[model samples]
Target: MKKVTVYLSENTYDVLNNLSSKRKESMSLIARKILEKGLTEEAAKDGIDAVTDAVRRAMRDILKPTEDRLAKLAAKAAVAAATAMYLNTQCIADLGKNNALELYQIARTKAVAYLREKDEEA
Candidate 1:
């Protein structure tokens, strides 16, 4: 762990203090938790990455790319990522991990679908 000094406004400090009291957590711990949650939320809300991905896909697809390009990319990326995971048995050790992978696949599928929807509008 590392110690760093951060200055917070009076209003923000008060909110943190109140939430810390409600959660029965120390102020420092509460602050760390809040920072982590904010990062996670920001990542979830990020549209720039999605926009960039869509633009690239649109460019490639527009360039008379081979068939199944999106599906091929998704399949390769998923298999590469999954092959890196170390599991002892054939069964999943944790359902959350599997769900996360599944969620990624669904998100990719939806992104392509939405991209096509947007293109139709344009």
Candidate 2:
């Protein structure tokens, strides 16, 4: 096997020294075994993390089209509701001499407030 030089902190060296004496093994052998085991565990953990990320990406990809479709449908529904509301308000509410533009703005403001109130309730 190839040789490698590594710097160890005083505490780490002391721990290794104690283990070597207790196990009757060389400090170099103990350090090597520990390093190998740590590397193996880290590699397995990294593999699991990689798989989890891939699954998350796959789920997002699968759900994206459905999300887009629902958003489009909701937008269409909102437009239809706004048009119907405007028509109903024009027929029922007294416009006096106020232009249709003013009425539209007023309706828009009311609609926004109503939506905000509903959102807060939810």
Report the number of the highest-lDDT candidate. 2
Error of 2 at 55 (Å): 1.1
* Total backbone collisions for each predicted model: 0, 0
Candidate 1: lDDT of 60?
79
Q: Which stretches of candidate 1 lie over 4 Å from their true place?
A: 44-60, 63-122
Provide the overall lDDT of each model, using Cα atoms, as 2-decimal numbers. Answer: 0.76, 0.89
TM values, all candidates: 0.41, 0.70
lDDT tens digits by residue: candidate 1, 4-111: 799999999999999988999999998998888998988976877898899998987886555577778989998876665433222333554556556556766896
Candidate 2 lDDT tens digits, 1-122 = 98999999999999999999999999999999999999999999999999999999999999999999999999999899989887866765564645766677787899788877855546
Q: What is candidate 2's CA lDDT for residue 7?
A: 97
RMSD of 2: 3.9
